[model samples]
Target: MIVSEQYGELRGRAFAIAYRMLGSVGEAEDVVQEAFLRMHQTLRGGEPIASPRAYVATLVTRLAIDQLRSARARRERYVGEWLPEPLVTGPTPAERAELADSLSLAFLVLLESLSPRQRAAFLLREVFDYPYREVAEFVGTDVDSARHLVARARTRLRDRRPRYHASREHREELARSFFAAAGQGDLRTLEALLAQDVALHADGGGKVPALGRPVTGRERVARTIAAGMTAMARFGVRLEPAEVNGEPGAMAYDARDRLVGVLGLGLADGRIRTIHSIANPDKLRHLGEVSDLGLRARAGERPGRET
Candidate 1:
């Protein structure tokens, strides 16, 4: 069979896997494209794949893992904050909700705690439900090593409680409320809505000035974010809602509409639990345009708005 015939069926799964692995849509796209190119090269050389879907998935996973290894160095030097690129896919409500938790900002941040190999092992086994042997093969390790890696990653991630498990609509509403309060500079409302132990993390790739450490406590985060937003407004920084990790989030743009930053929200029990803001210019390459808040507002007005 020709490559084109199989491309459509494989692309979504390939992208999904790569996105979960790299946490950047742009990187995921690059990995998927590279995987396809390799597939084509093999096919043109008259090599047959035993299972095209599995073959493509494996190829993408390997490419993403390699990319992650390099990305670690880049992230270490990032400007202010580093956030994953938002994925705004057109999917059904059910499908979008199913992916929301796995793709959320908190989840992606938690993945950062693991080494690249461990991340690959954990994602394959947990997210993709791959058997230990399959994950080991994908990462070029023994089954026991892969199992250990997955186990270690899981233990670290378990500390971070799961975010919103309610319906997508409910979660989106909560995000909107948070955004509205932040935009309006309603400190009282913001503090009330945020959990007492809320944490704010910024990934600036060490290029931009950002909080070098995580900001914890509801009062401290609220004051810090509010002050930052106040300064941003003075310099014409704008925030607009965008989809990050399949959930409601925001992106920041300067007066020139240049992509400045991306924000990710972590919601627990209908309150803001964590905030991740990525301001590194290098990381914002995937966010082409400064998303207009007006547009997002209108989009949300529609019934059953699914991120």
Candidate 2:
């Protein structure tokens, strides 16, 4: 019964906040739905809202903070490294690199180091460009306290935050070459494109085979990626170029065209600094039909290679 011209834009913004705060697409979607439902109820009750945008944002942010707190324990117990659900954005026009960097898996993983309220305050102030007063109101803190929260978050992420300096076209071309070299198992070319301290992170979530810990250093990471690509080839998996979280990346599909995984890259100093491979079926479901990777793993199936 609640219909408005601003509903679409509001919903998009609400999802963006929830997704950044929680780093889970499904949970963010649920939070947005619930937040809007509450909005409908409030309006139906004849409650006059001064600013629907601010109200919805506050609802979504607080709800996401609560969700993050409850999810902390589960993440602590999660098998292998827990990576954010990949947001496979395909070929969207380049926005501000700063904004794009904030959505990277590397940045999201670094945010995991912060406490829930700190994370919320930092994202609201830094990424979403919210004022301290509004951030305080959303997170239920004073203005000074909100500033303190954001400052502390900045301190914690100071060393680990990702920086981007490459042009969008360069990033895309580099990513294409990087993925191509990896697919061909070209170790030399792969190493040439990677930073000396580059790291490869794979999240299988205990559903399929994956590296238990991050593979670091150019030599090690390159070898790991080359080997993994070989294994994927044996199982008829192919990589399709994509833009994951606003950065150049790729998606893995099985021979039957079911999405099996997503790969995202982090670039700094004109070189790939981080490689994020998300293969968890649960995480891939939102993108499209998810391949039953677990079943294949259990059955030890290795079909013929495909182009």
Candidate 3:
């Protein structure tokens, strides 16, 4: 097939692979674009690619791996905590349901614990179903090394899997109950729905005064969320259900329809285990305007509540 046709077939898959590896949609898109650009240049210069699709995917993956190395250094210097950029595309309801677990904030956070090679190996193997040899080629590593990386990543991830294993329905239900309880200032309901060791971690990028430290204990998290909602109410901020990192979550918007913050929930055993509220101005760039969600809404929707 022609390079153009080959790119068309592989672009979406490549983008998906890069995005999962980097956890940054913008960066992933850039990596894919650059890969194609390189391919175009090579073809125009009369260099033959054995397989255009595979070549481009390999280019994108290598670029993403390098970028991840640099990003890790930058994140190490980041003020306070850092979180993945939430995917807020206006997807269909069905797409939202299908992508929720793959794009959940908690899942992405867990991925951060892996090294760049480990992440590339895991996503290529688990998400893309690339064989060990194919994954090794894409990542520019030997098959044995690739296998080891995937195994190590899996071991680390297995330890945390239980914390985020709730079904989509159960997670959404927990998110809804937590939000309603906070909105209504019902401390008892909040306490009942939250795990005793629940924690609240906010990433405001040091630009806003978020919880610089994790707020541990269910009562502490409840009080903190309640206080936050009360303060927002004082500032005329309204909370709405929104798709955050493919999971059921809330977003805070001002009277003018500008996104002010995002709320990400963590569930365990059908109870809220963690609440991540991101209000940093710098982090809101990708979120655009908060509007009526379709699949994205259902992706983050808490059931048992009136629209």
Candidate 4:
């Protein structure tokens, strides 16, 4: 069927849009499936659809905006700091470099600060490269309004937007050094690799033990990583290099080789600027067999020790 063929071609792009908009893999996949179902129904019902691709995009965008609006309340009440579900992109430096600017965890976290419509307009125009008129149509606004939405979104995000100043090889090297230092609890090396104002964010969803607030400043961030890594290493935890959210990251595995968490680092000025760790079992279920960090915490296996 023509619809089937179109679904095959458009599914990836549609999922990308939804994932970027909703920041949840399961929800994004649902949005894409629902969009295609509607498209299939419309086609079967003898409705004239000009372009299946555009129709699907519109459906996905609208669905994702609604989903995001509803998800905001839940996130506001979420336990600990909320971070996007880690998107494991594999360990490919070139691909990671290519996608870091738009697909990184930090970028998605920044997008979370915008209202649903503003997010939609900003993403449609800035990330997806849609025309102002098309963005307006997608978000149900005039071209001028769409432009204003994007401009406002840009202004809001200007201060914290991710900007990569390192090459692919440099990023790879920095990740290696940073993780190596942390794994070894080498505080001096970690401090050297971190930015002066670096911040570390972790999300546990109250299902595990994680920092309730970001640890800012190079010294504090490095110290936190050093102590946590030392404690985790005692439990036979190992950090396996991986790409997360299109950025250099690692997956932590427990003694039994079960996934304990995922870490995504955001680089700026050739230093590690942001560190995102997702240890919530609910969030790690998609990546692999998630370890029971909460149970472990209750059993006296907690991360970090007084230094």
Best by TM-score: 2
> Please, what is the whole-model Cα lDDT of each candidate in the order they appear?
0.77, 0.89, 0.77, 0.87
The digit string of per-residue lDDT tens for model 1 on 64-133 reads 8899999999878765556676654446677775566677777877788889888888888987888998
- Residue 213's C-alpha lDDT in candidate 3? 76
Off by over 4 Å in 1: 3-5, 77-81, 142-144, 206-209, 254-258, 290-307
TM-score, model 3 to reference: 0.85
Q: Give a tens-digit lDDT track for model 4, residues 158-269.
A: 8788878687778889999998898888899999999999999999888888898999999999999998898777766789988788778999988767899999999988
Give all candidate RMSDs, comma-separated.
7.2, 1.9, 7.0, 3.2
Which candidate should be chosen as best, given lDDT against the real structure? 2
Off by over 4 Å in 4: 1-5, 90-98, 299-307
lDDT pick, better of 2 and 4? 2
Q: What is the TM-score of each predicted model, taking all chains together?
A: 0.83, 0.95, 0.85, 0.93
Residues 179-279, model 2: lDDT tens digits: 88998889999999999999999999988888899999999999999988888887878898988998888999898899989999999988999999999
Best-to-worst order by TM-score is 2, 4, 3, 1
lDDT of 3 by residue, 1-307 (tens): 3646655778978787788888777888889999888888998899988887689879988999999999999899988888776665455767665365566677777899999989999988876688999899998989999999999999999857434557666777788888898988999999999989887888877666577778899888888888878766765678888767666788887666877788877677778776777776666777776432222232554322223
Show model 3 residue runs off by greater than 4 Å.
Answer: 1-9, 89-98, 162-169, 289-307
Task: Give the range where candidate 3 is weakest over 10 consecutive residues by summed lDDT.
Answer: 290-299
